[model samples]
Target: MKYDPIDSNLFKKNRKKFMAQMKPSSLAVFNSNDVFKTGADSTMPFKQHRDIFYLSGADQEDTVLVLFPDCPDPAHREVLFVTETNDHIAVWEGEKLTKEKATEVTGIETVYWLKDLDKKFFEMMTQCDTVYFNTNEHYRQAVEMETREDRFIKKTKAQYPAHNYAKSAPILQRLRAVKEPEELELLQKACDITNHSFRRVLDFVKPGVWEYEIEAEYLHEFIRRRSDGFAYTPIIASGNNANVLHYIENNQQCKDGDLILMDVGAVYANYSADMSRTIPVNGRFTDRQKQVYNAVNKVKNEATAMLVPGTLWKEYHVEVGKLMTSELLDLGLLDKADVQNENPDWPAYKKYFMHGTSHHIGLDTHDYGLLWEPMQANNVFTVEPGIYIPQEGFGIRLEDDVVIQESGAPKNLMGDIPIEVEEIEDLMNK
Candidate 1:
């Protein structure tokens, strides 16, 4: 692993919290992600399942975590089943986590090999009345691919037909939403990397640079800073490309006076930082560009202040919509009559700023959090507000990761990253 070791206590605390939420006599299982293959013998990089990684801190393939909080043997309460490495695996794929190292990483003293999972899990199942199966219940998830957890759930249910089943997603969604101090530290590192990379791009961006060239600059900075890379497929959208919300081709040449919208971030130790900034392709934003940029920046700042504890996610966005609506009206994108006859559901702001104002940001870029629940202190979210005008041939979005506070304003992780028109211009010119 390129990243520094995470304190195993974070994983321990996570598992303890998760296990506390489980019903009595219930055993939970979490499986690492399958090593996805692209073609014959070629494989996509192994990314561990965020749930398992969150609870176990074991970022490896072919690993499983079982939490039987009510097990008769206390030592077996938290067990990790890892891929046992031999000479061939070590020689070919490098070092897999040995039992000692797995224990050191996960704080789970009891470890088993993958081959023993079935027999051992079956034995544990006989003692527990219900089994908690980790499932994908994230709002944005549209997984067509069957995950390792899915396979495990199928086999477990078929093998133990009489056992009651439960979903672990709900508990996990609540637990993972609030960050521990250690998790926050890791996230801060990711955001700091993103901040530096954005600065690097500011210096690198020019009138004639290709959008992909900008993406490459970000990637280079991220790698040099020990980041795994972009939190998601980067959107280096220049000019009209910004109108297409998910534009990631990054192939178009940036023209002078055009604004480039970069929706990019860096990942540190599987934690994610999501940020979006629209900047001038040239050293300075044109007067019209600055007008739109300031509107988005104003909305972003106002929206961020509403992220304190007890704010509901949906209501917060509605409030943010109101803010964006006012900004758009001021920018001449919306009129008073447009607001008067606006569809209550769609609203007049959709004409210029269509996307949600914010979302939870953590292990996954769009991380898991109960949307219906009130925001809590320590919960992290992105405050991204945008104004897109295809007719103007450019869009403006400004984003920053923030942590909701109990008493005051949410802490902006990207606070140091330049967003002001003057600051950005100064950096670009320098």
Candidate 2:
């Protein structure tokens, strides 16, 4: 919990939106993420489930949120179940949230101990006809490990087989896709922190510096600014390592006249900002590198324009592909024959630019948005386009976080951050 406390109104509004979508007499439950084990006694740092955090603003582990708007008892309408913190437990694990503070953080009037959940939840389950179960239904999700929410679904089904079960994922998917004004404020803060880190790295990076050192510079800035950390695993690949896509090793030394592809961001109040930028270690891109860099930047700018409202997610990428193809042609990386002979599934542009151009981004890096649906306002996305040339020992990518607007183009969250080749070089040399 390195970040500052979020405004409870955001959570309150989120809960209101969720409840409005629920069918009459239906109750919903959201579970915090489990603290994963690294080894026997070693456990990975606790990360709150984004959904619970979204609804309740409760960042603590082992917490549960119950929404029973139609409960017979008025006090049971909205409740938070937090682990009870006693004197002995406080001494062992530091201080956890107390009942008073839990109410303050969540704006939930009723708070109960985790020990009282089963008895109370059973009482509500019998009163309600349907239960809204939280499940991960993001398109990119390939969850192999059974999550806390999964176990809850299984156990609840067995416990109340007669009660109708409903999916909360669909409601959440649509709701979380649209950002509230308060959510945007937190996301902007994350982007501003990332901007500071990127500027610091620009000055710190030079020939002979290890790639991991640059990664350290980014994390140091993020931590000092009170960001939880990188939104996802950072990619600090230097020179040809940038072509490898998911290069987290960051062990290679940066050389003069080479580009470093940093796909990094910061998380503030659990909201994510994703950015990717390629910069020359020597603070000046060579003639050939400048050509490739501008091409990618051009592609990025054009791709971002496609994120406006009412655009299909798949259609936007296809249009972006055409944009990239034109840039690749001008860069002499692809010719007319290469474009003509390319397979429909794997286009000619995939040779230099393999991965996707944009993805929904917010709570998670690859966040919740139905890919099959048309783009809408308040939907945040990242525009990342890269041209990787392994043979030339360099890769170029330029990215910015953007929000889909009601009309015109999406607003670029990272627009203030330096991106032009001249601007980056001048900032680094300064």
Candidate 3:
């Protein structure tokens, strides 16, 4: 891991919170993500499943965590199974966590090798009537690939069909939504790294620079600052490309007068920071660009202020849409008729500002949070509002990651990053 070690107490607290919600006589299991294959001899990078990482602080593959708070034996209450390391394996793959190291990292004193998992798990299963399985239930999830967790759940069911099975997704969704103090610190670090990268881009971007070049600049700064690369696939959209919400090809050359909408972030210690900023290709924004940019910035500020406790996710978006409607009207993109005749399903503001203004941002870019529930303090979210004007040959978006507070306005994680039209122009020209 490039980042510094996280305190194991955080993981200890997370496990305690999760186990508190588990049914009596129940055991919960979590598996690390698979190292997916690219082809015959190549494989994609390993990313630990966020759920397991959240509870164990074990950022390695082929690891498993079991929690049985009701176990008769105290040693079996919380156990961690890790792949054993040997001389040959260590030479080939570097240092893997040993038993003592695993305990230090996860705060679970009972550690066993992966080879003994089946024997130990079977013994525990006999004592518990119910089992909790971690499943992906994020609202934006569209996973088709069978994961390590999937195979474990399938085999467990086949082996112990009589056991009462329960979903761990709901419990995790609620718990992971609210950031712990340690998590908030990591998120702030990620955002601070992103700020450095964005400032670098401001100095590097020129009229004729290719979008990929800007992407490379961001990557260079991220790695140098100890980040684990981007939080998500970056959107380095230039010109009308910004109109395509997920545009990541990054192959176009930025024209002199066009705006480049960059939806990018840095990840530190598995915590994610999401930020979106649109700036002119040239040193300064055109008058019209400034108008639209300020409008989007205003909407972002107001939308962030609405992220206080007790705000419903859906209702918050509805309110943000009204704010965008007013901005679009002032921009002359929507007239009185456009507002009056707008379809209730897709409002008039959809013509320009189509996407939602905010979403939970943390471990995963679109982190777990129940949409129906009211917002709470410590819930981190991205306040992004944009106006994509294809007809004008450019688009503008300004976003910031914010933490909902117990009182007053939410704290903007990306607050120090340049966003104002003049500030951006000054930095670019400097």
> Which candidate comes out best when scored by lDDT?
3
- The per-residue C-alpha lDDT of model 2 at residue 100 equals 97
Order of quality (lDDT):
3, 1, 2
Ranked candidates, highest TM-score first: 3, 1, 2
Better of 2 and 3 by TM-score: 3
* CA RMSD of all predictions: 0.8, 1.0, 0.7
Q: How many backbone clashes does candidate 2 have?
A: 0
Poorest lDDT segment (10 consecutive residues) of candidate 1? 117-126
Off by over 4 Å in 1: none
TM-score of 2: 0.98
Question: Candidate 3, overall lDDT?
Answer: 0.94
On a 0 to 100 scale, what is the lDDT of residue 121 in model 3? 99
Clash pairs for candidate 1 = none
Query: What is the C-alpha local distance difference test score of each model?
Result: 0.92, 0.91, 0.94
Tens-digit lDDT string for candidate 3 (307-332): 99999989999999999999999999
**In model 3, where do residues sit more than 4 Å from their true spots?**
none
TM-score of each: 0.99, 0.98, 0.99
Worst 10 residues of 2 by lDDT: 1-10
Q: Which has the higher TM-score value, candidate number 1 or candidate number 2?
A: 1
Error of 2 at 107 (Å): 0.6
